[model samples]
Target: MDGVTGLDVHTLGIIGLAVGIAIALSFSLMSLVLRGMAALHVWAAAFWLLTFAGLAQGYDENGSFLSAIIGSVLIALANAAMLIGIAMHLGHPLRWRGPALVIVLFLLIQVGFMVWPPSQPLESAVFGLKSIFWDGWMVFFLLRAPRELKAGSLFTALVFVIDALFYVARGLVSLHPEMESPELASLLTTSNYLFGILCTFLLSTGFTLMLSQRLVHDLRVAANVDGLTGLLNRTALLKAAAPVLQANREHTHAVLLFDLDHFKAINDRWGHAGGDAVLQHFTRTLREGGIPARALLSRYGGEEFLLLAPCTSANVAVTLAESLRALVERSPAHYAGEPIMFTTSVGVATGTGTHIQRLIDTADAALYQAKRTGRDRVEAMVSDPSAGDRVNEATSAASALT
Candidate 1:
């Protein structure tokens, strides 16, 4: 009761809750630790939160001095366990020489402090050293807590630093047993401790928020992107194209469609491995050094890509279509050191708020005509056969992607 009188009941309750939470967290965090990608947060949180409680309880207990030292050793073990768990999850090798030494020394000091209480004037330096070492560990861990450097390890270190710095400051205050003004010293010391607690709270909360934000962003990008081809997936492409189509009410637009000619033959000749290499390589070319950062490029289907050229004229669309055709003809990818020749028939259609579906249908017809006329040729869509006015066309060339 005498020990409890000096401590704020609220802080005591918080410390209790933190320890209870840590016990609950072990069940949840252990499973994730076994998995490769988990944050390992549940255990880290509980471990650190309860650690403060243990330290406070140890100091408060009127029992033998060794209890506090044992408590410190237990907390250090939890930190060590967290580091190992994180390294396993990341598949990163651990080199714990420096940090391990700091932890071992910390345990030794805690035991020393219990064995030799601070009531004696000669014990001041020992208390100060222990406090300083605790602060040192905190700083070291904080420095290492980024994803590239073991984020979980860094966060856990920061929490310990907070706890350690608080003790060090308290130890420093105790060293000056007689100050200029006892009341003033007490006020300043209390403010510092309160602020340290706030900083610790911020470190935990801040990382939690940051991690959640990153996870959400990654999940969203994965859902909307084609994992294999790295383009806007089918659904995302349509969703993006829908808005562009609706806005082209006053201007004519073009759709240039291209399908890789003799693609299946390459798969048959080489192998599915060769086919995949070809697809990935050819898609890079189709991107034409990357869809105009502003333009939308999408994989419409196997060996088929759609480029939506907004408010583009037939002449411009034809030129771009031919560009794509020429690129594909020249960029014959190889697998197993064998050059794999491939080509695509391109179709282009220009329409102004007339029929978007017709735009694609007309291009499809032209694509078919190109394939029918010759395997490696471009053909324009003729809106009226009698007039022979080719609204979309491929240049007369043997090589499609020049």
Candidate 2:
């Protein structure tokens, strides 16, 4: 069969072989910089080696069974390397047993072929069965992967399934005498070779997309999460809170600012590492306590945190803030086999308007008041003159109590 520009099967194989080598080199370059990209590098190398083996056989048209047998062995190793690369990408523990066993089996198959050479049909059947089983195995891992990777994995798995079916069809065709005619056989072989190259291209594209998707996911997590406390950082908190503030303009929402009292003294006594331990302990306590899931807790700054709770009145906000204060005072952070007790001052402010910044400012003022009056206490300030007379009066009453 002549492809575009009258290219024969041998020419196509050479082209495929060239493309495989380029892909291998590209992956090799990437592996040097990107951690874990070595797996993909190995996959590309295996693919190229298999292509090299096929090209070798094509070049040696003479009855040198040795070249073909060597190609088969390379195919076995290539399959094993492909599996190893996939397992590494999926974050599975790399195991040597599977690839080792595949190598051993392929070596034995070579010996068996040399002893009593099987017919074309028998050889096709044996190879096809092994290919189908391994392809199925690859598909299994893809299907069982995480949801984030499902789309890409499934796309690649479909290619593997199609390749498996191709082998099965080839094996069946080899058994039929009519299909074995020189013309029909040549056409079938050319078609198989073309389809195999297409499958390789698709697989490579899918794998690249998988890596990109994971990189984006990881970057998002890194941007949003606080490295020290694992809470949402200040920037992320503000981004998340903006929508909630807009929607709850008419509803009551509370913003509580928490500052660890005398935190500088703790840092001075325990050093920075111990101070880090205390901060971690405080964040853990906030999570473990009955903090509502709907609320957003963020590390506001060095020793300060912010909790934004929607649909809560001034009275409820005060109660919640008082509970948090007590919880922190009770929880002691243990470091270096000694208990380090600490206390927090909380400032509570309720808002019935769309202005998040105003609420935050009011909460900060109350927090200042809490620290000024005394540490380890909760202070309320719901003073918003613009939010109608009733709201202002209610907030004024709460402020008066504080």
Candidate 3:
């Protein structure tokens, strides 16, 4: 290995081979452990093909015709795996029939060439064209990926585009009569090995980062979202609603607490499964109830949900609550060919303060009142002046947060 410019050609090839093996192993573990990301399995297979291709190249250098043919086929298969993996990641439907046939035809042609090797220029042309075609396919898929993929997608695209262009240029250069010389051919091969090492390192690191980023995003979503209803959890709701309430300079903020009436009876009659279905049914109605996107909707607890709406006035809050109540009353949950009717009692309270807890407490008081007076109705609570002043002062001083 060179000491100044880093490792020599042989060392770089060894390192590249090791990296390829490590990538295959790492991705295999990721696929087995995660299970959900099937694309990692595809990528693992791709790296395995890459490793085989490398080994086959060594056999080819030793004049092993059969091994070289197998390696050539593995190269095409590797490219195919990479393409399929990208498709899976992007939520795209992969129609493999056409591409599979093309790969088969490519393999046959390469095997035929190995059986009766062509002259230097002809062989270079064939090999270069094959490389360009597959690299171009990669570039096409990367370009078509959604913009939301951000850093990972962009980095992968750049690497593929450069690799594709390099193959094209290499093909054009190989047409020169000078390229037929043994020294030139050997230099070209060595340069390619070096470049492959760089490509492998870049691709493996980029993909790992992409996987890490996706894991982080999924974790964040899981933390904030309620598993049963797919709504925000209580913590997330309060965290989100605080800013809206605090910044309410012109409009009053209203908190509406909803509780399903006779929920335990539904559980007792229809079982836990039926109760769950009813809850999901009500959530669907709420989502379709034309609630403003800015409003925070959350699963406060079992059979209870909270909505913080920035309304024009208390009247608007009451109207909104009444409309939601009516919507739930009309929609019925169907379980086992039987319709289960249910209703929700809502408590709406409008206030002019940054203290979200105070608002929730006031709304909860009204909610209990609704439950006591009648099972299915909406109730509004007026904030006491002295209580409001104390809350505002405490909210300004302590600014306690959950």
Candidate 4:
């Protein structure tokens, strides 16, 4: 095949090797900076293996059996590694058995070909079929990715689909060897090399973009979520609720404020670790307690939580609050195999319009009332004629207790 085209297969192989090595190095560096992303490391190793495969195939001037077998196996393994890395990135479970069986079968076929050398077209057909299988497998997974990763996933899937089409064409062309003149064969080889280079670069770029998108999503989550309870933070809750509140101005919204009763005592008795465990326990209870799907639940601050339920009535809000209080009271948090008794005080306020701050203030006043009367109780204040009357009443009552 040498000198069939001005830029020969060997030259293309060398260029591919150089490009693979460069990409491998970039992925390796990315793995270092993005420490926990195991996909980056896997992809780096895959590129290195692909480079080795290129080297094994490129220098085989005599088309040696050993070089052929080694190159085929390494190339297959590299493709498998790429699929594995993609699974890792998407948090999908790795099912090694299927991929392993495919690789073993592919290796056996390569070995069979080496033992009884077939025509060039037959060999090319086998290679093309194998390439198509792997590329198709990658496309399947990429297309099924979650909505959050749709952009990068779709782009990468499209690239793989194109690659599969190339292999399909190669296979079809190889089947009709009688139609392949010297000039046409040369053109196909040149096209293959150029397309191979293009696909390799595109695959790497697509993977990098996926990693970038994932990183951005993770950073955004970290910023808006409470590290301990995995609940939305105050800022995130406000940001999320503002639009909903404004959109449903005609509908009533309920804001429920909850303070864990005697939280400091729990910390004092069982230490901060125990306190953390209790907080987690409470969070789980809330999740399992049939909270409305559209409720905006957040960790307002230490030992304080807020829930904003849109399109809810005052009665429903108070009932929900009481249910939560009872649930918490009955469900004891265990620390060191001992049951740690604890409870929560809930204050609920319901109103129409987009005055989220006003609703929160009213809920705060009611929360003060709950604390004053008795901890572990549910108290509620509805929006009165002036909207300030209930808040004033609760505040005056709270002041009397003080």
Candidate 5:
């Protein structure tokens, strides 16, 4: 292999090929393990395409036009695949027409260059511009990613920008080769191959980090959220509200416990599927009824939900509960051409302390009172100031109003 100073371009290419293959194999295995992540499969395919592109370009001893065209087209397709994978990862709709057009135009331009034998500088400029186009598109999308994935997305975008800068430098240097020393040109070529190997590894690592972050976030959400109603589960609600409750002992916090009235009867009349529809409908109604943003809402158990609102007074809590109850009563869940009307009984308790369980117990007592008096009503209880931090028993001061 010819050496550019102490560095060998051929050896760098060989190492890049090995590294690309290893990364591709790793992605392929990950895709198999994470079958739901479609982006991984696309990325794996992209790497394989890149490897083939390298092989096609490397073994073309005579610089044959066919081999050159094959290599160029394969590389363009590989980049296109990568862009598509990014789109998939971000949950964006795939639009392949533009990338396909770019590839076709690249192929046609390569054919033109082969036939007319363009100057080396012009060829390098065109190649570099093509790369910049794709890199710019990828950077745009990465920058537009959601804030939660900002770290990984920004790192990947930075790497792409650096790679694009290298291409720009290569084109600029090739443009005025007569002004530079032979050693400089050789060094640039060697540096290009070395950068290629390094960039490929970095890109792969960045993508894997992005994927791992997404996976961890999804796992956490799945663990905390109720699958049916898409609300926080009991344990999650309790865990999340603990800090809020403990933060300010003087602030009044309220817990609203809601029990759907006659839930079992709905299931009996409409089957389990219809009952599920009603549950979803109730959740939507509660959301649409202007629930406070600061409130922590969760499905506490079967046909029961709990909402913890910090800095809420007794009056505000009761009003919110009444509003939700009325909203649920009016909104009917439809299933199989039948409307299933349902209602809920609510228990509201307000206290000034970190005793969350005490507040919940007081709210549950109020809820029991509401159910006992009649279903589909709101009952409220407030802690007695004389009792200090202890949440007092349910009070009749704010009685269930029909």
Candidate 6:
């Protein structure tokens, strides 16, 4: 048909071949990276490859019923495997039992496709839909991922999206034309050649956006996290705290403050270099044990930390503060190849009509009280739940003990 028409079949074939190779290589590379990160990554990457492969093969001859059945089975299995693996990595990775469940779904879909088999011209649609799934995931990861790799992954995904769209458009134009031409043959052939070239240009632009997004994401992360400990830095903390401070101040919330005991003396004895090492180690320890889903952990200053847990009661905040203090005190400290012990003091205060600044002042007073009475303990201003009751307690204590 292409030969009878005045279309450049040679150029069309070359363009298609180039795109197919690019898509295939992308899958192989990404699959390798995903596999290194977690199991079933290959399944996700391979789905894109197999979809293109099916299109290239099916175009030769509408795959026979048996061939389509086999091809469909492979594609379905790949998709199912991808969904299962990603769901597992989210937490509670599925064992062998999961693959068994996924295979059942694959077999069911395989049976359906086998019965119908090549009823519609599915080549372009097959390629497009499959790429959309992978591309969606790539965009999602780019948004949420912690580092640079997230951006790189997106470039390949964008190429697939463009390939998928052009193929779908090509299919639509070939099947349903708005205007009828005297020589439909030449029109169809010429359009196919033109679309392929268009795809190449789109692919280049999409990749540019993908890489740019990655660079921006990485720079933002570097600014937020402390270089040594990978914890949020002081600047990051203040910015993060601003919203919470306003929220709790407007609607009564609790705050817990902590300061490491004898931190200065230890740093003075074992150089600032060793001090930094110890601090980084301590940050790691805190990060290891999971924090509350809503909790924000930030470094307030040197030797001081803030755990701002919103919508919490004063009593509960005190309990948490004490536990954190105990944990830090128990953690082993090594400097200059020698074991050293350290402890922290905590102060808890709840906001009612108090501003964030006033809350910090109250908490600081309680922290000073902890140090004065005995280090390595938790002291809370307004130990009672009722904010009004705290003023009464302070007054009574001052009058009698005065």
Question: How well does each candidate superpose onto the true structure, as a TM-score?
Answer: 0.60, 0.78, 0.83, 0.91, 0.88, 0.52
**TM-score (C-alpha, index-matched) for candidate 2:** 0.78
Q: RMSD for each model, in Å, please? A: 7.6, 5.0, 7.1, 3.8, 3.6, 9.0
Give the candidate order by descending lDDT: 4, 5, 2, 3, 1, 6
Candidate 4 lDDT over residue span 157-272, tens digit each? 89999998998888787778463587776667678777977988999999998998899888999999999999999999989999999999999789999999989999999999
- Candidate 5 per-residue lDDT, tens place, 1-402, comes to 244454466677788889989998999999999999888899999999988888888832245865679888989999999899988887777799989999999999999988898776787789899999999988988888887777888888998999899899888888774725666657776777788789899999889987987798789989999999999999899899889988877898999999999899999999999998988888888877898998999999999999999998766777778778877888889999988888899988888889888899988998998899988888777664553323322233234443
Between candidates 1 and 3, name the one with more favorable TM-score: 3
How many residue pairs clash per model?
Answer: 9, 0, 0, 0, 0, 0
Best by lDDT: 4
- Which is superior by TM-score, 3 or 6? 3
lDDT scores in order: 0.61, 0.78, 0.77, 0.85, 0.84, 0.58
Error of 5 at 347 (Å): 1.0
Better of 2 and 5 by TM-score: 5
lDDT of 6 by residue, 1-402 (tens): 545443355556566657656654664665575454442354335445445544544433234664455555555555445444433433334454645564555456546665765434354344445545544543443344334544434554455556556666656654555424535635654565566456544543444344355447658878988666676876786677677766655555556677878888878988888788778766765665444567777766787766666667655566666666667777877767887677778777776643555666777887898789787877778533567465434334432421
Clashing pairs in 4: none
| Candidate 5: RMSD to truth | 3.6
- Candidates 2 and 3 compared: the better one by lDDT is 2
Query: How would the candidate models be sorted by TM-score, starting from the highest?
Result: 4, 5, 3, 2, 1, 6
Model 1: residues >4 Å from true position, as ranges? 6-212, 289-291, 354-356, 382-402
Off by over 4 Å in 2: 1-10, 36-77, 87-119, 143-151, 247-249, 334-339, 383-402
Residue pairs in collision within model 6 = none
Model 6, residue 53: distance off in Å is 17
The runs of at least 3 residues in candidate 5 whose Cα sits more than 4 Å from the true structure, single-residue gaps closed, are 1-11, 59-63, 92-94, 179-189, 385-402
Top TM-score hit: 4
**Ten contiguous residues with the weakest lDDT in model 6:** 393-402
> 1-402, model 1: which lDDT tens digit per residue?
423434653465455546445543643564464343354453465356445535554433344544465655565555555454444333445566755786788767666666665553334446456545645644554454446444544565566566576666666665575643646444543464455445445544544543444456568778777666787765676678777878776776777777888888888988888988887887788776434444677777787777777777666667777777777788888889888888878876667774566777887887888788775666666443432343523343322434
